[model samples]
Target chain A: MNLALHDIRHNVSRFVLTAVGIGLLLMIVLGMSGIYRGLIDDALVVVDHIGADLWVVQRGTRGPFAEISRVPANLEHRLRAVPGVASARTFVSHNVQREHLGKPLRMNVLGLAWPEDKGEWVNLIAGRPLGQPHYEMIADASLGLPLGEKLALGKDTYTVVGITRGMVASSGDGIAFLTTRDSQAVQFDQSGEAIRLERAARVQRVRVNDVGRIQPSFIERGGGPSSSIPALASPMVSAITVRLSPGVDPAAVAAIIAAWPDVSVHTRDGQEQLLAYGMIDKARRQLGLFRVLLVVISTIIMALILYTLTLDKIHDIAMLKLMGARNTMIAGLILQQALLLGALGFGIAWYVGGFVFPKFPRRVLITPDDLWGLAGVVVLISVLSSLLGIWKAMRVEPNTVLS
Target chain B: MNPPPDNTPAIEVFALTKTYGSGNTEVVAMKDVSLRVAKGEVIALLGPSGAGKSTLLTAMGLINPPTSGRITIGGRPVLDGPKPLVDLRAFRRHHLGFVFQKANLIPFLNAVQNVQVALEINDVPARAARRRALELLDYLGVADRANNLPSALSGGQQQRVSVARALANDPNLILADEPTAALDSHRGRQVMELFRKVAHERGAGVIVVTHDQRSLDVFDRTLEMEDGQLKSSQKPD
Candidate 1:
């Protein structure tokens, strides 16, 4: 340490510059690690908040939440009959962009069943749950939705009923929950002119087909659109989120539901794996590539700088060896300098990285644990880099000093 | 502390032969060279260019082991048939000191620190090392520069620092390879007389390898080498 300190003192500016270079590289790696983690955390944030153990979607699709899952509203009655089912409900969900205070705000609207039971779906932060269900909405705190503010939803305006925290969706939009009926209305209601045009088009097509014959299907004196009951509604919907009764095995429940053969069920862990290795696999891979590149760049730069420093000290080393200094002492001097560089770099990186990341659009996460881990990496690479210089120093013949 | 003075030679070399390479490229730098130096003696080694004076000093210093030789320091077998009798680095640390042509002091250290480093390498305590380093610096008339870095000192003062460093551990023998080669005539003679003072007063065996013969009178004894062999050993004018 003494000789190492002396050498560093002799070359203070050069050593500090190397530390700064290493610190910048460390900051990059820390940012990459945080980004990969944030993606996974954000993707599952909505599902994790949903607090459901299983999902029930249309038999043929992983759909709805994962892909596209839809089932008849009446299926909730049949699902109630399944063994071990405490309760079953239907919900509709979709993504929409609406003008909020003259700014575009993306909102994830979820039509939850029995708004009073929303406890299982979201944690209310400020307002109360829906008392009457219609025209009321609860927005996530991230949406910047003020209490009692009216927001346009399709052709109608819905008032913000309550505010909630941590209700983000997989796509990072703030979530707003409404009653299932309202979500259904938002999805299916058409404009007046479009409805009138659709009716005229249908009448024209019918007249062309039957001419003077009585149009029996439209002959009934029924309310508008009642005559087209079957054709007017969309049959399939997004997947369903299911929560089982206490102690019911997810695997077994999934198997019982899979008896329909087309629907797929995933356990919690399996769902996480899907998100980690399947859905966001590309993002993770990208971050991994970036981390590797950063490490390689740092190693090359540090090795080159260290080798240059060694070249500059060749005479000093030859003199040391020729003066009868031991090989360990010389090697120790080099290795100590390397370790000190790592230590200084890590200290500066931790501070600079923390300050720079929150301002970025992506969350830059650097935990104390992460800083320690980066320290380990820096030390390992630094020590390895120093080996090249140590080897060169050792190879310098002390006999050179004589010449 | 000075031990009882003895007539035994401080260094002896017998049949010291050093060769490099083999077959058609064999080059013998030193062939069967034999020489000895007694205590309290300052010997000058003079030779032409490539005459192998450095090799002789390095071989005697144990920096370079001879291919074949028997060399003793203070009656201890140091080199036996070209092999060292003890750990080469430890032996050198305890018994041999070197003064190169340049001061070669560690740049970050002052004169005293430079000398202290040598004593510290021998495991001396810090307080004792500081006192002895100061004393040696004072003896060489550079006590005022003890706190000054080698770069801050004049060329002569830096040489004094190097001399103080060489005597830090009270070694039995001191090897100086062209110690005065980089100094002016006055500074060179001052350094030569310092070596004589260190030998006679401190009872050390000093061997200086140099081509300069103008200050040969400062040496108690002098030797000349030519073509890798010692030609004469006698008292100088």
Candidate 2:
């Protein structure tokens, strides 16, 4: 270390130039590692944020989070029957974009059961949670919409009653929650009027063409089981999120649930892997390739620089050997210089890499473990780089002194 | 030289031979050479190009290790029957100093650093090594160039740094292979005089292999090597 440090001091400019080149390459390695991590995080953001223990979806499907999952609404009742099962709820999520206060905001609208379910999916960052079964909405806080603002969804205009924080989906889009009935209506509200009248006529046994009369008979006024509102078409849900009690064996429970032909249940771990393996798998491989290429280029550059440095000192080395210096001593001198250069490059990369990230719109997270891992990598690279110089120095014959 | 030294010499070799290749194609570089130089004296080894002067110097330097014969330094047998009795590299480090044809200062290190690195290799403390290097540079009268890199110094100044480096280890014998071959006459004579002063004042046995006959007066004795054997040109005073 001492000899390497002295050599760097002897030729500061040459070493600093090599270090800068290595530092830039290292920044790319660190960035790729961070970007790879970010991609996985982004892909699983919704699953991770939903705080679900197990996700139930259609059979032969990895869904709700990774795929489109659908089951009959009564499937929740069946899931509750499983041993050690707590409660089950259904939600439907879809991407929506709208103008709020004159700026476009993209969002995911989740149809949730109200009263007992409002607090489960949405936590109020401001104002209040959903209080009404219809006509009230809670938006994501990042949407920047204030309470009492109105949002238009399909054919209905709903009032924003509250704001929720950190309710983003796997795509990093914020979410808004509405009542299950309202959600169902928004999802199908744009259907043909003739079809709606036909659906209503089938339920009421009257050829009523008026929208007002249909709502009075079917949507609003019916309290008795014999009322005129047509039953929802399949009234099926998008998917379900399940939370197991502590110490519950989730895999065992998932297996028991998967036995039903109409359902597929996945543990949280399985779902996370499915999302990474199925969705972000190719991206991780690309980043690995990028990291490997960067390292190869850096090694080539390091070898060239050290080789040049040794070539410049061949005569001096021959003289030293003739002066009775050992071959190991000369080798040590060159190797030490390479290690010192690597240390300098690592320091520069940490500084520049730390400062330059975060300005990127995508997250670039560098963990403490990640930085330490890279430090070890740099040390190994330095050792390998020294080989070129050592070989050159050792090949210098003492007869070169007489020459 | 010195009346054929009746006592055992500091450096001695007998019938030393070095041959490259064999059979149908062979080169007898140095054949049947014998010589001796005792302690605390200066000898000038003179020869023409390709006359095997360097081959003889390298053998005596213990680098090529003569194909056959015996060599001893400091009254202890170094080579016995073509096999070296002592570790050549360790023996070289602790007992010999060498000057080359060129100044050959390490380009990166300044003058004093070039000298101090020798002491450092032998595990001297940094402060003591620095002090010793500075003292040698001062004694060689190039102390002003102590902080200058070899590139900044002239040929004479660079050689002076090399000399300081050679003396830093304080070996018992010094070998100068064409040390003044690259310098002007004035610088060449001054370097030879410096070698003469070093041998006389420091009691180090110095042998300078040179082709420059102009600097013969600086040697206490002069000898000529032709066909790989030495004969006295001037008797020691």
Candidate 3:
């Protein structure tokens, strides 16, 4: 007669309430899994979208995301001149927090090598890609920057020409794209006071040196502009991204560049691996630990609940036993109830997670594999948890019904 | 209805003894108990609290094995001195029925389902078992409460359902341990009369243990137990 279902039907309110409590706990576990997946996805999103064949960073550095990397801007020209190199672009990225609409806005400012690559690969949902790269910017929708909105930073004011969706950096901050020079201007930006102090110090150095007296033009130009000076080198880039021509092997080109004294070269897959394992490994482990702990806690709670339920029906169990019910029949009652509880809880988690995940500050991506894996875990937990109740039931003596 | 011949015994227990503990803490709950009940006979086991009536009843019910004895039901030996002659559980499922003091219905199941489960335990097909359950409920005059859970029924109505469940498998022997303990005098007499009707109509041997002397007239014979022994047996006047 399906005694387990019959019992639940008799006490439906309590069963449903208990399932809801368990469902919420399961939701947190599911959310942890989703957040862990999201972390890896967020870390690799830019690397995948850039579609570079090779990355050339500063020598002896993992950069540009895992550590600091700075190569001269002219490295792009040098990379383009190499055999089998289809195209090369200077890559620059740095995080910036600026005030907009009386609130702090944080973003990863990424430089697009303009006139050659204008962020046409970005998943733009509104407006167009960077048409005029100087003062035009493509901002992610997460930054709350609408198309055509103007944002002032450093000495330049940029108008948002396009808005992208779900384009976040490894740190979970939205990205804003600008031309290489503008991004460099933002990266090395200094306050007027700091600039004046730096220029004065340069003039003083020139005055105190014997070479400055011999060459008066050096002192005069030192106060004019840092860029115009012959002694000062050009601004540096974070890395140089390279695209290889058809039938060209990236390893051969990378091996050639690896011998260079001033730069370290990496294939695209190598860069992605470094970013995933080297950057977000610890966070992934932490989330995995939390998920395991939660599953354990869930199993314990379900065990106690099933045990108490069996205790409540101890008399009924005795009567059934005296009536010659086999051990399997009684055990099936508890086991089926546990399975039903787990099934109900999982259904609730999946339904409610749909509404709750998108609202999280960071991306919560529940993949099909994660769903199937959690379902398997829940079934295993239900079976393990029902053991306590079944043990108690099997020990009930039929003579107790007489007493 | 015609009564079966005395030669046809539904159950026979020989020299049954049950004890608990050992040495200094040894306690005899029942000793050297022997009895025989014929088909179509309704008898009562009357005694005070702790008088070994329930001990003997449980032994006869095959739930608690005796320290020593032979128990045969429906002319087949089922237990000998705690050693089982056949599969005891299967024997109980097919050959015996029991009604406890409080009706002891599985609270979750409705009246008919409670009865249907007994037949199902004996491997009866569900559809036929349900039909038999409803027929038994109707015979006990509780068919209208077939869909009602135990809690929803009155005490008297629940007992009727319990009796209906006992008859579901058409068992040869039915045992009752103070089956009317929770009912009023009138309702208790009604339950006792229903047991008599079940015995006479179905030819099942019925043994009811009770402390109520008012329902003595409903049984054809009565046995009294005291200090773990059968002290007397008499046919009711």
Candidate 4:
């Protein structure tokens, strides 16, 4: 015969209606938090799968994520020569969007040199890894690309050699693998008209300058503006990923590379920090703001509901006071109702999030830790919201019944 | 009215005075009002509007304390001159009950649960409280409506349920403010008669403040008030 249970039994519909209202609000709260967690997970999946101990990028850049980092492809040779460095690979990556089967698909294309042993970076769910260069590609299954599907990037078309699962960028874009030469051509190749104009400009400048008594035949024999370009010298790569020898500390090897004036070095932890805190900072903050706003809205709604309920029961409160029920008892009645609503709402939201969040276009990772944390917040909000009702109930004068 | 064979009164108020505001705005709601009632006595307090009848009822119920008074209930002195001599809330819960002008039955609870809550608030076990609530409802002739909410009952039935609630703790005194004000004459007399039966059979003293004089015959004795002063009591023929 506790007053809270008794009252709720008497007004079962109202209690249930209020619980459901708060439940939907809680669902949004849980959903936003899960999306933030999912964003972090999506960002780290590629980094985790790469399994490299250290990343070597251009000087004064954070990494491939924060800014454009271009290091000479030849740096891989110099990196392999460092003590405790087992292997180094030239890795190039870029964001690309193209129409695939009439739908615009965003992908993060990753290019690596062959025989680098980095082909194991992707977990193949179907078909084999990328064995041939240039025309074969491995794509994440999230792109809905089946094995043997041909996709065109820029001017080159490649067949999907393998389908991997759960390989996506921080923005939830599917990942694709390309050969080094093909990716560079897709990224840096200029249009025919622009290349012709540049070539004519180079030849005209050479003929006008006439340095070293060069002849027109000499320039034409040198292959018509091709020899002047540094094609055979060295190619540019996004970054050099380094693997350390066994029993060697990555920080020690990274320190040795940091001394190179032409390049900057990042340990595995530093790159992860760049991805989590720097690359995704804005999106996380936006989601964080939304989460806070939802929580505030929920608290205000609960408080208003409890306050209105207390107002509606003012007469009953005075009667209880007249019946020799203390202020503490009335306060307990309101507080208990609030906590009950909070518990029920959290339960509903947790269940609903588990059931429906997977259908969202973006990954929404609702973890057990998030549930516990959100439950704690809901309880705290319930207790604080009940304060308004408790105040109203306590202030009700028993003398009002006599008047 | 005196107790049968027992000298101690269920309620005793000596020189009770209650005032509102102070200085130039001072209004005395009760002026030197004094009275006593013994166990099993059912008394009616009749007065016109602003005659301080409600003020005296509220003071006796331990809700609004008198500015100056010595009050005793169930042989225990609970208040002394504007200050409490004991825990007022506990003393009230243990010894007193009240019914208001409206049935004032908690609208959310059914008739039986409404009565049961009173005993539960006083720390009575739930099962025993339910049983006692049923007994009180039966005694008040509203047991048939025990499971119905207050809104489903008529005015007289609600008052009867409220009376049953007032008796839930086996209190020594029951104070009701215009319990029959909302009922028709026939239903009003029935509710008044219920108070009489409750007092005579349960051995609890009852005081009802009302303006309805048509049901006066049900009281063992009736007291009148005018200008915050008590008049001599009238006894039934």
Best-matching candidate per TM-score: 3
Best by DockQ: 3
TM-score: model 2 vs. ground truth: 0.83
**Descending-DockQ candidate ranking:** 3, 4, 1, 2
Task: Look at candidate 3 and tell me the lDDT of residue A395.
Answer: 95
Candidate 4's DockQ is: 0.68
Task: Give the alpha carbon lDDT tens digit for every residue of A71-90 in model 3.
Answer: 99889899998999999999
DockQ of 3: 0.83
Candidate 4: TM of chain A? 0.91
Deviation from truth (RMSD, Å), model 4: 2.6
Per-residue lDDT of candidate 1, residues A259-376 (tens digit)? 8765666666666667667777887899999998998888888888778878878877887776667888888888888889878887777778878877765445566676777878
- Please list the residue runs of candidate 1 whose C-alpha ends up more than 4 Å from where it truly belongs after superposition: A89-93, A96-111, A117-153, A157-167, A172-231, A234-237, B1-6, B21-27, B80-82, B125-131
Question: Per model, how many backbone clashes are there?
Answer: 14, 0, 0, 0
Q: TM per model?
A: 0.87, 0.83, 0.98, 0.94
CAPRI grade, predicted model 2: acceptable
lDDT of 1 at B138: 93
Q: List the residue pairs that clash in candidate 3.
A: none
Name the regions of candidate 2 deviating beyond 4 angstroms.
A77-83, A95-235, A245-256, B1-8, B23-25, B80-83, B227-232
Model 4: lDDT equals: 0.86
> Of 2 and 3, which scores higher on DockQ?
3
Off by over 4 Å in 3: none
